[model samples]
Target chain A: MNSVLDIAFTSNIKRVWHPVFRQFGLLALVLPGASLFLIPWLWMLSTAGKDTALIWKTPPVWIPPVYHWDNFIKAWLQGDFAVYYLNTFYISGMNVIGILISSVLAAYAFARIRFPGRDILFIVVLSTMMLPRQVTLIPLYMIFSELGWINTFKPLIVPLFFGDAFSIFLLRQFFLTISRELDDAALIDGCRRLGVLFRILLPLTKPALAVVAIFNFTWAWNEFFTPLIYLDSPKLFPITLGLHRFIGRAQIDIQFLMAMTIVSTLIPIGIFFLTQRYFIQGIVITGIKG
Target chain B: MAARSSLADFVKRRFTQRTEDILTAYLCLLPWIIGFLAFTLGPLVFSLVLSFFQADLFTRNIFVGFGNYIDLVQDPLFLKSLRITAVYAFVSVPLGAATALAVALLLNQKVVGLGVWRTVYYLPSVISGVAVAVLWMQIFNPRMGLINNALKVVGIEGPSWIFDSTWALPSLIIMSLWAVGANMLLYLAGLQGIPTHLYEAAKIDGANVGRRFWHVTIPMLSPTIFFNVVISLIAAFQFFTQSFIMTNGGPNNSTLSMVLFLYRKAFQQTRFGYASAVAWVLFAIIICFTLLFIRSSSLWVYYAGEERDE
Candidate 1:
């Protein structure tokens, strides 16, 4: 009595019809849906590799007539991308280190230690996570200006050492899942507080740490608003601001711009792929725990 | 040997014990506390004062006693920017969430090449801001862009896109879909979290695919939906950079987002007090929506293994 489309779910018909009918049925549903997500990236890649004039050709060339390697070189040197990449990577590295140390320590305390006012403090941190960054943007800028930290990496890097609320929450959640018996055993084995944290808990929390690292790295690398607000010097520009400047002040060579876009995208894409499982797992855990 | 060791251990433990546990805990929490004070709470408190005072980087503040708020009401462009932003957020969040959830449901099935599809879907979201915006700008270019070229193939004329006042916001909304992968992934996580036993029970009760989705999946996924809704709404309100970069708040200020307007006001024109008032107004609006959503969530958001009072 089931229609062909509903046959996949009907128990009696599914076993008989699944081979071609159901599989192809799924393909019909999945391919078009998948293409909506996939085509834009493909177009970007294609456009990046194509000739500048050929891009606007009326018939729309899906395949490039010839690959232009010079676009990448021009965008790299002419666009001042070397300075941007260096500044962004350097900021990202400092951020990773700062977030790791602070978030791990804070998470460990919240998860394991007994202290008065701990619950209230944790609540405060969680609430801060929901607040949009704009709420704090103005005052933070003024404070940095007062401290003579504007136009320097101080505004960018100094805050990382103070722990991000989300990172702390994430690490704390991960730490709670760890067996406490390991802590007691480490304690009885002539280990002290820092020792347990460094050797046992930290190593066990690698996935969580990687998630924190990935988030900080991407955030610092791509952060434009903060850099725009705080840094006045062109030399202090992160890649995001540098690229924005490129779009505004420089050439409109679509070919070169696409190449530059690809280059800028590579680091995050590389990071995502390298930590693929961890990214998925980390996000999943966070979503479920929420 | 055991007796001797036990006595020595007892003495060591007693010596190591201190009533400084509170101090030790605080040491761990020191960085966050400092950060909270300096970056978050400090800025928040200052924003209120800055809103009432005509303050910027150069000039010392002159308190204007709600003059900024008064100007905000009279300012035509401010109201226009708010309307534009509200429209953008209201339209995009629900549409984006629905598309993301739909794609997630499709991807959740036992489809072949799942990894390829997932990576492809998530690829654009990870690509960062300027790059994606630049790419989309190219895609939305007036005549020679990919979208127009495709439209040509279908014998339909494409609008000037970001350049055209009528189509600019829609163009941005369409571009916003390119990164629905982030939302899709969250929904996927929510979907996978649903227990298989529930599905089995539904199947035994003769529930069809549509019925299972409506009855079992929806209620279970309500919490995730609520969370995404609130988060996306906040993000939508804070939208900038794209409008700032792509159209410079546009041909007729059609795409002049509130944040873009705030950025221009505060940084470009150096009207810090007015900008601070704008930011607080934005914050207030966001708080209103968030509270509204949170209150309404209780009517439908279902947490498993828990019962709520009517």
Candidate 2:
């Protein structure tokens, strides 16, 4: 590989003098790739900053005349984003706690405990990954309605308490990677199973826990379908559903809508950045090794 | 002393040991077992039963014995939804997978600011789906949209993307390709796993960059590609959000996906039985496709650890 690197370096140096070929090749790959992802976001930012008349102008101004920072405040007030933020935070927080507890306990069982039919049960759990949520939606809705849990946060929070297959799988993979010697030592020390989980496993698996937290938070935050179907009142609406209301109420106000969109999107990205060290480590460790 | 023990004592000890093991294991599994029974198995069986009956919002279900499936086979809307879903799946999965692989290959080059570039590409995938859809709706607006204005600058007229029946599904496909970051990350992992010695040997044999890529890089990355393809296909078949948010299956039902149609039938029209049937059919189709892919994977998926048969 080092030799290949040397040869590739020489070849690249020789090829660089051919400016036209180099530029074309580089531009062909990089330009389209970057523009495909970036241009729309740039357009969103620019449009959000523009005034109403300028937004509709021909040859659509790539830059706004003056940065309308008020669009953010206006969108915040008009969209009732403060309420949406609180609602989203509350639901997502509850969901995160629910998923973490359920997933960790389930993962510990699958990873550490031995019992008859364990493998069969694990397979049953994994098989649910293939079953699309659409298949379960109608019947689940009926069950919820019968229980009179509709139009409440119960439908949203209760499912997470039962455990999610993906989160369980991820945490199990992390657990399996840990050394069994530690568990044996804990056992010799007369630690009960639950004590081992809390005192030993939980402390060592912070990366996995962080991954679960971030994943649950993001999924709960961005979830649209269930929240859209379950929650009827605007006061209970998450940011995702709240943004939809903005479009529904003022479809023509592109500037205001884009501003609200940006505002709503910022928190998740911020969360990702803050927890990213553990997130990437979690993925590379659990996903690849498993 | 143990051998001299009475049969009652031995039997009692064995029974206690058995009970202790079972109790400990079951205690560990208690939460997941309860969850599986409640959320997964219960709903699964309920959906299966519901598919066979006719029900409305205000009344109990009437068992009709496959009547919903029969109605579905004869229904034009169901057929249209299936066709639309098939096209959406076939087009988007391959396109998204190919784009992700290509971007991954390009970024795999020893380039400066690679981390920054990776983050920029991944930003859209992390953005709220509603926010992305709403933003793209503005970008794809018929007259005053950014896309049209950009096209007009180059003397080309852009179509009314979401409003035009001809362009609506394609417009969603275009929007979906923006979030190729997840697959890109997967591919990057795959790329990193390729052994460096092979590339070294290829260089010693005077293989050029393109040749090395085709012969070495591609063969090594096939498994990751396969994984991405199957997963992406499954996801695309259930496509709902873009159509739900942007087109709402409008302009003559150009984008009435299977999932979207199911949602409308169940929620909007309150036809729970027929919607449940549609959901089952979609699930069956997804399973069939996945099985087919799994069957075919042995032909192309190169397992690094497997020994070749002589």
Candidate 3:
């Protein structure tokens, strides 16, 4: 991996300036452009620490004269982010568990089980990934409404229990790569198909499981459209909904809004930074296989 | 008679075992099957049926026989939203693909802190959804935003983004550039997969950097590029949250997207039938574009497994 990633014509660098100079030359090309990408985040952090008057400054105060430490607290209280945070955590947590159980089960079957029509069934599952969610949105909304699940967390969390097309695809691809000898070895010990999955395959696929957990959680955390449509009441709203609703008042309440935005994004960003490898690996596996 | 009876019993036992294996497989697939039937297939079939009826919150659903779709043809708002969505998809797909490839190429350069640069560039996708929309709203604020403030630094007046009808769509396009990180990562992986020996061979031919990129890098990465185009196109057509949260399809409805239009029709106006029809239209457009993209791939997309130009 380290070797193939080096594509630059580096022989020229040895003939030119010092080795350190070459590093600086590459950084000079990359750093300026990268800083621009980081600006919105940095700019938001700056505003979160400033007064409303300073936020509107033409030259823009890169650093606030007064570090508003209380802005986070103020935003936390005013936005009622405690309940929103709890709601988001509950929804995302249940969503991840649901996705894991269903996807792992289905992926194991698809990868290992050699039943009649298995290939056709697997293709059907894969094809669902391409179906536009919008096509089904109206009917799903109406169905939940009829079941009296609207304005509640049921609509948001229940669908995940059935599994997602992408997660199933991801896990299935990972499962296919594992040697089938492990499953056969387990089965010879008087284990059933389910036992083989639990005792051998599931334990072996931890990295893939981690990948699913990360993707499902991040997706649930950042989800907006579904919650936007279903969860009408503020009490049940996730942070995304809360932040969106608060934007109307963002003009008048600039300080707290910036602080709230910063707090809301912290978890997914943290997860991303922490688990960068599994996340990128998941993408590569999916991209190549799919 | 005894020999025939033994043969029949043996066949019966084998059939039962096979049935059991098949049953176990299905039991494993039960969640997906049930979910598909209840959640996916049911809704799709229901939506199709609903599109032919006069369904709403106020009145009982009345079968109207393609009335909603016919109404779609004449409805000016539908046409307007369709046009806006079409334009957004056309511009953003290519721009997003090009920028993503560029970022991939830049990051592909062998350097120290490569991981750090990759992470920083991907930062925007991490903090996305409504947070991203709200963040950009402030950044594009005409009088006080960072973009205009920077423009003011150079003594050129900045356009009123997201508020002006002319610039609202374009502003959304600019903001869309921020989330190209995931696609970039895929391209980065594609870059890695291309054996370095290809580059050594290119250099042996005395290919310059520009020629190497055009002849080697682009062709090698064409499969990834093709994937990006299709994925970006499907996503771009479903442009909702940015316009929905930031502009609400406002400033003379210049930024009114198809999904947002469908949402309003169903929820706000209680025109479920109309909304269902609009969604079918969106789905059809996506299918057409996807097919077109696949058809065009043979002309440009180069599979590494196939014969290469000698």
Candidates' TM-scores? 0.93, 0.91, 0.93
Error of 2 at A100 (Å): 0.5
- Chain A fold similarity by TM-score, each prediction: 0.91, 0.88, 0.92
lDDT score of residue B161 within candidate 1: 97
True contacts kept of 2: 0.61
What's the lDDT of the predicted structure labeled candidate 2?
0.84
Which prediction has the highest lDDT against the true structure? Answer: 3
Query: What shift in Å separates residue B278 of candidate 1 from its native position after superposition?
Result: 1.2
Flag the better candidate by TM-score, 2 or 3: 3
Model 2 collision count? 0
lDDT of 2 by residue, B1-310 (tens): 6665767776886666556656776776677789788887888788888899897768887999999999999999889989999998999888988888888887776555577677777778887778889988888998888778889989998999999999999999988888888788788778888999999999999999999999899888887888778778888999888899999997789999999899988999999888989989999999999999989988888778864221
Tens-digit lDDT string for candidate 1 (A1-290): 66875765676565777756866877898888778677777777787778868887877787787888877897788888998899999988999999898989988888877788888998998889888888788778778888999899998899989998889989988988889999889877877766788899999998899998997898788787888888777787888888888887655678778888889989999999998898888777776676
Residue pairs whose backbone atoms clash in candidate 3: none
Which regions of candidate 1 are displaced past 4 Å?
A1-20, A188-190, B1-18, B306-310
Q: How do these models rank on lDDT, best leading?
A: 3, 1, 2
Model 2 chain A lowest lDDT segment of ten: A281-290
lDDT of 1: 0.86
Ranking by DockQ: 1, 3, 2
Give candidate 1's error at residue A217 in angstroms: 0.7
**Residue range B1-310, candidate 3, lDDT tens digits:** 9999989987986677567668888898899899999999999999999999989866799999989999998999889999999999999888888888887887887778889989988878887578988889889999888999999999989999999999999999999998888898999999988888988998999999999999999998898888878878888899999999989999899999999999999989889998999999999999998998899989999887754211
